[model samples]
Target: MVMVKFLGSLISVDEAVNKATRAFKDLVELRIIEKTVWDALYYVSAEDILALIDQPRYDRSAVDGYAVISSDTTGASPTNPAILRVKGYMSPSSTPEEYVVRNGEAVELATGAPLPLGADAVVMYEDTNRVGDEVEIYKPVPSGANVSRKGEDYRKGEVLVKKNTLLKPWHLSIIASTGINSVKVYEKLRIGVIGTGSELVEPGYKLSSGQIYNSTSVLVKNYVETLGLAKGKYYGVFPDEKEVLREALFKALRENHLVITTGGTGVSDEDVIRDIVDEYGEWVFRGVAMRPGRPTSAAIINDKPVFLLSGYPVAAWTGLEAIVSPTIYSILGLEKPVKPVVQGILARRVPNTVGYRSYIRVTTRIGPGNKVIVEPYMLKGSGILSSLVKTNGYIILYENIEGYEKGSIVDVILY
Candidate 1:
């Protein structure tokens, strides 16, 4: 029921988050258990993995190619090739018998064969012509040519990635090369999502004249799932009646670590979540100084954080970012999630509100001279979902800033 302000009582986003974080002060003992490598794809962590290992490891080659010394082929060219007599071939899986590459001799090497004594390079068969016992090298192979040195891709004791990193395929490859069988990652938090509105109905169900499709429930669920941070449990659609919404919120708060409710945080009479939460729980903070998401609400109910987010898709997303995400991060003991930010020139003028920070969707790419050029997406209303789909990300307008002029450098957080 409280509308947060900035002047005497209003706090900036940074200050607000800081205060909220300090208020908690490690109140929750939730330890997001570390998952194995196989589970890393589904869950991200708040800790870096590189800080765990202490060893030098290398991935052996998986190919078959000659490993030879390089200095012997310097003057060898395609026109006047250098010829070296075939000494012998070494196969992998068996210890290689040491054979010195005398100036005019080429020792055959299987893929992954360690460089023989006195050999520094390997020339592929395609680049050489063989006549009887002698091979003609057409290209000048440089020293260390075609060689994957010890720990070229990874080194001993090198922290591949820090804790709290989302494991990608490339990250898996790096650790796999280091002979790491499993990894530690934070466990995914469970989220309970409740949607409340008498005018709302589930998409597949038959709807009456006054009922609209339930968009908030589905959108909130999808957003939570997409981040790999939490699994959402929908409590179905409830009516705007205080008793109905209150019961749903109560159940959600009890069952999950985080409860996110969409569509009932606005100022309209239909909005009942704020009043209900205020009656049942202590309000951490309410309202924010951001456009399209001003009606955001936060509270701690029965020891669990409850977020009553705005019904507008963008507003809901912002509310989640401003309130819910920080709680999730703290619960999992993970670093703050950062949106991809880049600097670009504004393609046109963008007016701003004086007291509120505005986030505008934008399309950006590297234009002439490799400079980033960002054009603001034309859609401005909180109701337009297509605008977000069309844009790559958002550009921020500070609370005190009036507007942005064309050609001005702006920072954009890419989608």
Candidate 2:
């Protein structure tokens, strides 16, 4: 077997990702569309949302108590209580015109009730006693106490949500507080996943001795869906032949907003996907300086992105996450999906090449004395899919780091 040389110098993972994803930044601005706040979850906001009005809308009671002229309750105590006439009651739906408080008067107000026009503070019910037609405040209450002032939460012109925000349930609530039922968001981009190995077969089908079931498509598709920025469409596997792969690539690109092809990215003679991409588009990067995904490549044809990923499941996943995912976040102005991380002591030493970034799968356990211990599954297995399944999280050894020593504290990113 003849060994193959890299097409050019390897680029840092960061630079490779920038080139692969940011090339199509122009397309994101065009995808702005209106969606109901309920349907906008996970979609990137297209514009800054300014509050239409003050958040409280009006001064509101923060407790179930008596809305009163705060000065009337001044100097009141258990032995010498201030007495005030009970003007009326106010519920959350009560109109201010009906329950206005006057001098030495109070209105019984429930929590969230709009403060009566003349009331300056609320004396909680527990601190007052109700008499025939008057209430006695046992404690002095200051002005603005227990009152949610108008515009306190958000000013009328303040930004409720910034442009390119990933809308969450709380974001929807804030938008709703502004009386906005719909929001402008970038529509979910369409991504096509195509496989290019002749030896690949569909799952559940009888495979020949040399053939393996295609798993990269499943990996890429679900990953895109979970990432929430794009909708993945799989265009069935194709042969490595140039004509077949070319047709497949064109069809997938035309049908989807972007395309990522698995397999046919190696340096071998049969790796003709690179040739097809070079013939039609400009190469963004031929390879990334990372282990398990050194063959990762990307190109842009007519402003559309096409990522070439390895057929190996782990490598394909790494390429999608390390490159494709970050690019989507950076170019579209969406926050990247943050993985939960834990701090733990390394169970064993893990080595890495100085120039390559490595993602080491690991499982953690609570060892003696409640110490969190991280166990790396394997240090070198690009094609071993089971390693990912057995591991619950991963620790990233950056390009400059050689390795981690056992018993050293490290951060683990839990999937």
Candidate 3:
């Protein structure tokens, strides 16, 4: 193993994601999956679905009526009804009876029954009188009136589903209706989360004077699951020891497609993650040009990705949203996930440092004239976990932009 110093040049969010995507471009595999197991899997279709057998497959009645040709009911009136002989009955069933209506005849049928071969329209029974095997029509009908034509819903050779579609329940229904029982989809990427710090204790354990409960593992796990990008497993916390951390990293790399660690990548002497990465892996990038999550780093070991995030809750979250999530989706060839946002007026002015992309947490309320007013949370420390709970979302200040004025409108990305 060779040691390499951390690269201090900070890249933009998009550049970081592109680099990560290039690294894992060929990492995921495609598998043939049955419809039964595709309920909630994140996947992209492997090929184009060019056709579907005609929907409904036949012309059927849209209402309960007598099937007749349009011309047969010509000049029909209440004073002098057009009389016709009743042919037969047609019902909607697995084995429907066949009945043909000639020029001077009509067939009685229920709603959704296939139209007889010679009928071009349907007249409701309300407009007719039944006397023995004859019926008197009182009104006229046009061709295709009250008829569900063949291929009305969908046609054969029509595109059923496109390639790279994220399958939903309705999408599955459509595919099933076309008689497709299995499909090829990109497999989900597996993620392993680990929290690191000597002073950190697992939740439910009594903390000593200098100890804090572990939250990053659970937070990262929940984030991964909620995004539907990958399945995540928590590996608890690792201390500031090189050998233990190295062993844990190796184990995680072997077990998962990607590994994420919270903490121990900063410049302080106690931060050992950077050192371990240099000694045991290859660095893709060591830092990003973003506030709060400046210590974020990425590496590859044994052909698996590893993301080192800040121990601070807010910074860890930012890293996941800004970098990790996009990379995962890119590798899977899925569209980038977008957070819901609303435009609002800033309640106060905010300052920012040049060349750093800043994320400011804010709470929103309805203002005068029904306008949304955003109030920035004053506490800006990345470690303040409660700030995240107090705010609904954050507004991003671009790297080149300084900040926004008190009344300026901005987009707030929701959590």
Candidate 4:
């Protein structure tokens, strides 16, 4: 068995992420996913798309009026309106007639109707009176007024959406308008999750004297799916035995691109994850200098990533947010996900250890002068899962910073 070298000092969060990114930079697999333009909502584009056809397709009217030459209605008013011969009516769907508006002629058309040949402007009916076959145009219009020129919205061969763009609703509409029926998107990542511990039991099962319900597996699966990062497959709970853990880890590694296991990462006798990593995998990092998740570890088995997170609910969650999530984003060619945050004043003094990064959970309320007041959750233990439910988000204390004083303005990342 290979002896594992545990780094004496913990690495910073940025260093850890950078290392993981380099390890998996060439591992992201790209697949062409064909989706109909109508149902392609929220799918990231795999390639840049060019317009196949122009919008409007032709010069059209923008209102229900008469199409005419601008020079014909020049200097016309109510008192001395320009009189022009009225031609046949034109609907939006009708083909443009083989006719032209002479110096003193008009063709009545509805909104969106194609402009007849030689017509450069439109005169609203409200500004003119009709008598027999002639109408009076009271207002003067310039060339191209009230006209939507062909290719005005988008020209053919113009780039509509760039590669790796997350398609929104409006993007789908635009693609459809360009006559594109389908688009290509990247495939979702496949992630395998395993929760290990002899004392762990699945939810709805009766727990024995030393057993607790297995919550981390479900949490990991749901969190991965909800973020649209990957499809999570839970392999159920495994005992702390080395052989059993090894078999499960090997199977998960073979089946998924990435694997995550919660529990058995600490330095206790039952913590068999470290030994398994030493025996069958290459250890990347054994720990990070972050509170609530100091024992988080990562390894490479058969050239695939395997993250070992703490069993405690809060610690497991922190590891996922700080480590696993960033790695996945890097693989997907996306920018790091940003958490919504609010600026607030710390309501009380909080102490922390220097050289260790801290995540302090806090609840917020509107205080005097409409200022947001953040109240830190007193219970800071990693095993206290209830604190997560009670607090909206957490405030980060950097590794070099000791703590925050009362009334200090800070940014709180919301859940």
Best by TM-score: 2
lDDT of 2: 0.87
Off by over 4 Å in 4: 1-7, 38-43, 56-153, 168-170
Model 4 accuracy (lDDT, Cα) = 0.85
Give the per-residue Cα lDDT of candidate 4 at 192.
Answer: 92
Best first by TM-score, ranked: 2, 1, 3, 4
lDDT of each residue in 1-415, candidate 4, tens digit only: 4443345668877677777888776765757789998867766788999999887888999889999999999899999999999987888887766467787899998999999988999988788889889999999999998999998998999999988776778888899999899999876677899999999999998989989988877877888877664779998899989999889888988888889999988767687888888777887788888887887888888788888888888888888888878877876788766889999999999887898888888999999999999999998787888889999999989888999999999999999
Error of 3 at 350 (Å): 3.5
TM-score of each: 0.82, 0.91, 0.81, 0.80
User: Candidate 2's residue-wise lDDT over 1-415, tens digit each?
Assistant: 9596788899999989777666767754446899998899978788999999997878999999999999998899999999999988889888667776889899999998999998999999999999999999999989999999988999999999999788888998999989999999988888999998889999999999999999988898888888776889998899879998888788888878888889988778888887887788888898898877888988887567888898999998889878888887777766676889999999999998998998888999999999999999964567898878888998999989899999989999998
Candidate 3 per-residue C-alpha lDDT over 1-415 given as tens digits, one digit per residue, 9 for 90 to 100:
3343446788888788888889767765546444442463455566666546887778889999889988999999999898888888888762223776789999888998888888999999888889999989999999999999888878888877787777767767777777777776655667899888998999898989999888877788899988664679888798988888888888888888889999887766667888887777788888888877887788887778898898988889889888888888788777875679999999999888788888888999999999999999998887888779999999999888888989999999988
After superposition, candidate 1 runs with Cα above 4 Å error: 1-10, 23-36, 45-65, 78-80, 88-103, 109-113, 124-127, 138-143, 267-270, 330-333, 336-348, 364-375
The residue ranges of model 3 lying beyond 4 angstroms of the native Cα positions read 1-7, 28-40, 50-52, 60-149
TM-score of 2: 0.91
Candidate 3 pairs with clashing backbones:
none
Better of 1 and 4 by TM-score: 1
Residues forming the 10-long window of minimal summed lDDT in candidate 4: 1-10
lDDT of each: 0.72, 0.87, 0.82, 0.85
C-alpha RMSD values across all candidates: 4.1, 2.4, 4.7, 4.7
